[model samples]
Target chain A: MSEIKKDLLYTESHEWLEQQDDGHWRVGITDHAQAQLGELVFVELPGEGDELSQGDACGVVESVKAASDIYAPVGGEVTAINSDLEDSPDLVNTDCYGDGWLFAINVSDESELDELMDADAYTEFVDE
Target chain B: MSEARKTPLYDAHLAAGGQMTEFAGWLLPTRYTELMTEHHAVRRHAGMFDVSHMCIVDITGAEAAAFLRRLLANNIDKLEAPGKALYSCMLNEQGGILDDLIVYWLEADYYRLVVNAATAAKDLHWLQQQSQHFAAGKLQISQRSELALIALQGPEAEAQLLHQLPSLGAQIKALKPFSVLRDDHYCIARTGYTGEDGFEIMLDAAAATTFWQSLLDAGVTPCGLGARDTLRLEAGMSLYGQDMDESVTPLQCGLGWTVAWEPSERAFNGRAALQKQRDDGVAEKVVGLVLDQRNVLRSGYQVFSADDELLGVLTSGTFSPTICKPIGRARVNRNIGNEVMVEIRGKKIPARVVKPVFVRRGQIMPGIET
Candidate 1:
């Protein structure tokens, strides 16, 4: 089973959100997402100031085997992105939860956060 | 929609941690570890693939050679000696390519052809239909279902075969590229799609697992169709269905060289149509494109001229592992220039057009650089 981080919220589309100290939400795909995609070669990150609604397609991750869209789990304005992915997309496959965080979103609507899944729920969701 | 057929190596691939995926109606591994690793193994070292899914047809009888000469686009007489091999395209009457195949003249009155798996049924029907024009009973064509195929490729392919199957050392050592060496028990061809020095071995279906295990025991990496595709793409080889199908002709797909036109009297299948098309002029042809960008240029992507005219579409495409950039083959206008733009994800990405061949024998061929 792929690792699911506790103390983090996840969407059905597989983005994991970690609440930062500044109330910004750190976003990245879960380990399960990266493993299925396999050997990522490129990632198209959303613009830093782009506004996204909950569950909107925010970016794209392409691997040798397939390509997938990255979805926003909560409504927010993009603040920062893992610029390292521009050169080393494999980080998303190797260290998805740590160094491979995709972008940080400054919250505009906190209610969308309540709809995210916790570790236990996500574990059940993925298994199904 | 029927259940996918499993080759004899199905269980073996699963045992080796292969991630299975359905391809061309066969259940096969997409990869064991990762695709690039398998690709590099074949490039820098050695890799083996379970190619039993490829359909092999055996033909024999007094009229076998005559039958093939009329059935294939290339001249079968080119296989002047026993064990000689010829690559050809089986085309329809309208000059549309049915399939690209490799036929080996094992000996007089006996020939073996390896064709794409997805087109096997239709190809067999077409072969039977075309056999009617000749002396019917004098030509016998049958599928070789009892045999399994293994492709051992790379820089070390010959060395591994010599070391592992030491008994066939003499024949394996003397086997020329595109030729085969066979006895009652084994048929080995020095051919491959990856543009690497390799051997395609055919043996009893019962022995396939044992052969695969022995190759793994010899430390040869296990590769899958995923790597097979990337390797062929980098080598500028075309996939049958993607590059050309019933809707396209060989001349339009960069396979004009495979056609033999020297012997004017030799009227092969689709000869009249191809001759007419050549006379009329081929308006579009397949060319290689290289994009120095992160995103991929997948098949079906549109090509445009610098001034924004529609040129053509990519037939086969992938992110080239050898060059770390996106490279693909597109069927575009005959007047396409050195530079073009490809519409990828709604944006026009500029690309450089070069010769259709990208790599050969594990080395990047000239003109691939952007």
Candidate 2:
């Protein structure tokens, strides 16, 4: 089945967010989204400290077939970037939910999580 | 015009959970899963493509060979063997390409021609007209639209397809490249479009659905036209409309080598024009370009010199599955320099001009130095 981790939050654009120990939130593409995109060739993620609003274009993902924009799930400042993806983008294809996580962000507003989808809601949204 | 054409294996594609889309006027499978996934599957293992939309035509008569010698751009005298197939272009007298087709020598006076689907009607009309001028009753071109074709391609295609038809196992093994064999029930050709070694099978349209499902049951991954396009593009194979249109001559589209100008006596349509171009030094050559950067270069993109001079236009391009880089074929001025930059979204990306065929047998070619 599609990966819908209960502890995480989701975006309609198919990105997932998990709260880290720090004040930042870990962000990555859900398993369903990665599977739909296929093999990842190149990734263009924002650098650390890049400020972004909710729904802002934070990065880009280019697959062998097409390129897609990675939108910020919630407003935040990119606290950390996944440099591993620069050399091994296929990690996104292999483990989209775990080690393939995109980046971490220090949220500009924690209440924006309310606008994001929870596991159950995201499941229903994707299914529909 | 909105009414979509359906192939015999349409239901099979649906049953396999294929994403359906309209391609070349037919409602066909674009992908069973992700396009890249299916494309990679074909490169690593075996993938089955539903190519029944391709029209197969048969020519037979006392002077069939003679008629084809004049009807096609390539000489047919070389295909003396029964199982041999020859790739040739059907061109108008004005040197415009009508269609590039594969002709199989089935008998002394019989030949099988496979033409692209989009140009099937126009090809048929052209062939009919040519038949009348080149000793009418002595040649006959019959459009066999009732047959269905399935292209099983990739490394393991032969073994997988053999399990489906045990009787043709030995025949498949001995089949050479660009050759075909006709058994009691089917015509199996060792030809494919994916740059992999495989066979294209033709059978009764009614039997197509069952045969397609049987292949799937044999663990043959079902692919669609989307994968087919990327696969062919990577293989450096030309698409009829994109790479070489009616306005192009074989010499300019990297197909001049396929033109047989031997014997100095074989008279074919467009030969004079082609000879003139060849003698006058062809103005352009189709070259392969590998983008040095991450951005994908697409067709209609402007290819320019580093000095900002326009060199050519990209014809077909895609992110190569094997190479993991952007590659495209462009027709550029022969006088232009080797290294050129592609204008992608207003920025110039450096590209290297190298040999046309980029990937072969699941391996990306090396030494494409700028």
Candidate 3:
């Protein structure tokens, strides 16, 4: 089972967002996402500072078995991208919840997280 | 519907966290642990694969030699030794491959043939039809679906298996490449599709489960079709339906080397056409391609020349764990230009030609022209 940090917020599509005290949120594909995708071969992350709407496609994560789109859990401005993945894409499969974190951002509205699933709820969601 | 086959290690795979999938009518593990992990394990150490779906047919009688000589494209006289196995293609009258098979010469009047499972029924039917063509002696073909097959491959395969079955280890140790030996219970062949030294063991299905468990206990990593495909492709081996089909001749599918044409009078099916192609020319050849970047290339991607001429389409493609690059095989016009591009998602990606066997021993094959 993937370690689901109780303090983080999640989307049904399997991305996790950690809210920072400065009104910004750190983003990364959940451990569940990487496990489902298998070995990561390619990643296409959105440009830094690119504005993303809620549920917008922010990037792509391709594993040997299949390719999946990474959706924004909530509206935000992409402040940073994980450039490390450009050369070491397998990080997504190896450390999906840590160094494999995809991007960070300034949240458009902190209240947007209300629609997101909490860690306990997300676990139940995946189990179903 | 007839029941789908199961490997002897099916329960063991489930226990060891392998994902099962249906392949050639058998419930086999597509991967254990993970595709890349299993792939690397085979290149680095020993990996065991359940290949029980392959059909084993025993042909016996005075006309067995002549029966095979006429039914296959390769000359059978070369298989003079008791344990020698010859890889050959069964061909149609039109020179197209019906199926590729390995024929083991066991005795003067008995031979064992291993064929693809998907084409088992058709191959058997064709063999039966050709058996009737013999006027002098009777030929008999028997299918042994009651047996299970396991392929233990990689650098450590022999040692791992030896650790499991010490008695059989001595018998298999002296087994030469492409040779087979049968004890009271198990038929062992030093043959594999992974381009590694290994054995394909065939034994009664009832004993298969125990045998598989023993190997696992001996530390042989359980592998699946995912690793098998990447391994075979890296070794430059052609898949039956992908690289060649009923409409493609072995000579045109990079398998001409398997056909024996000496003593031209040894007439085999499609011998005339193959000889003609040899004398005239082949129109196409299968070659390997390596993607320029990390982008995943897939089957059906069209190949093009520098001047934008369509050359061929990819037959199989994957991210090679050994090479750490994308590689594939394609049948292209025989004189296809050296430089070609693969059209992926409507964009032409420049690709370099490489002799297959992209990965060997957990490292990318070197000296390939890009």
Candidate 4:
């Protein structure tokens, strides 16, 4: 079974949202998502300052077998992108929830976090 | 859903934590460990592959050679010596490739053929139908479903094989490439798809599991289809369905050398069509592509001229683990220049046209920049 952190909130599409220090949010794919994708070879990141809508495709992650789109969980402006992935995309497979964080977003409405699934709910969803 | 067939080593694959996938109607391992790890294992050390899904057929009787000469594009007469093998394609009347196979002359009257699994039934039917013309010679065709195949490949492959079966070291080491040495239970051939020195061993199905375990104990890493694909791609070898099919001829698929046109009186199937195409000139040819960027190239992607005019389509492609770069084979117009564009994900990326061989024998091929 894949690792699921209890402190993070998740979207149905597998992106995990971690609340940031300045009331912003850091987002990255969950461990389950990265495991399903195998070793990642390339990652196309959304540019900083770009506006993203909830449930929209923000970027793509490609492996040797296939390519998949990464979805945004909540609508917001992109505060920062993970520039480290440009050189080492396998970081997503190594430390998915830490240095592999895809991007940070300044949410237009922080209350959208309430609509996302909690760790327990997300784990149950993936199990089924 | 219909059930997929299982090979003799299916359980072994599952025991090794392999990810199972359906390939050509059989449940096979796609990968055991990470893709790059298994790929590098074969390049640096020895790796074993369970290729029992490939079909084996035995042909015997006085007419076997005569029937094959008329049916196959390659001349079977070249296998005059026992245990010699020849790679050839079974072509249709229209000069299209039916399937590519390796035929081994086991003895004066018996020849064995290893064909693709997906096209086994079709190939058998075609062979039977063509044998009618030589009824007086009396040929017998039998499928050897009870046998299993295993391939050991890499620079260290011969040493590993000799270590596991020390008794056969002399004979195995003496066997030349495309040559086979067989006892009652095992047929060991110095033949492999990977552009590395290796042996393809065929044995009774009952001995497969035990043999696989012994090889693993002898330090041969078990590889799956993922590594096999990347290795063959890097070696510039062609995959049957991906690189060529019923609609494509060998002349266009970079296999023109496999066709033998000697003894002008000997007429083979598709000879007329191939001769016509040769006279008229082939319009499109398959060539290798190397991406200038880090993006991965995949099959069915469009290839374009430098000025954005569509040139052709990518036939087979992958991120080459051995070369640590993206490489692919594409069928483009004959007049295409050295510099071309590949449309990946709606963006045209610049690429260079070079020989398909990115690596061979654990060394990078000449003219391919690392």
Q: Per-residue alpha-carbon lDDT of model 1 for B63-143, expressed as tens digits?
A: 999999899999989887999999999999999999999999999999999999999999999999998987978999999
Every candidate's lDDT: 0.92, 0.86, 0.84, 0.90
State the TM-score for model 1: 0.99
Chain A: TM-score in each model: 0.97, 0.96, 0.94, 0.96
* Candidate 3 local lDDT, residue A99: 85
Model 4 spans > 4 angstroms off = A109-112
TM-score winner, 1 or 3: 1
User: For residues B116-140, what per-residue lDDT tens digits would candidate 3 score against the true structure?
Assistant: 9889889889988888888545778
Backbone atom clashes (below 3 Å) for every candidate: 0, 0, 1, 0
DockQ comparisons of all candidates to the true complex: 0.74, 0.30, 0.54, 0.71
- Lowest summed lDDT window (length 10), candidate 1 chain B: B361-370
What TM-score against the true fold does each predicted structure earn? 0.99, 0.85, 0.89, 0.97
lDDT of 2 by residue, B143-239 (tens): 8878999999999988987788888889888889999999877999999898988889999989999898888888888897778988998888999
Task: Return whichever of 1 and 2 wins on lDDT.
Answer: 1
Instruction: Give the better candidate number (2 or 4) by DockQ.
Output: 4
Query: Fnat of each prediction?
Result: 0.48, 0.30, 0.52, 0.48
Candidate 3 fraction of reference contacts recovered: 0.52
- The candidate scoring highest on DockQ is 1
What are the per-residue Cα lDDT tens digits for candidate 4 across B1-370?
Answer: 5689999999999998889999988899988988888889999999999999999999999888888888889999878699899999889999999999999999988999999988887988998888788865579989999999999998899999888788898998899999999988799999998888899999999999999999888888899998899889889888999999899889989889889999777798999999999999999898899986677889999999978899999999888776667899999999988999999878899889998788888998887773
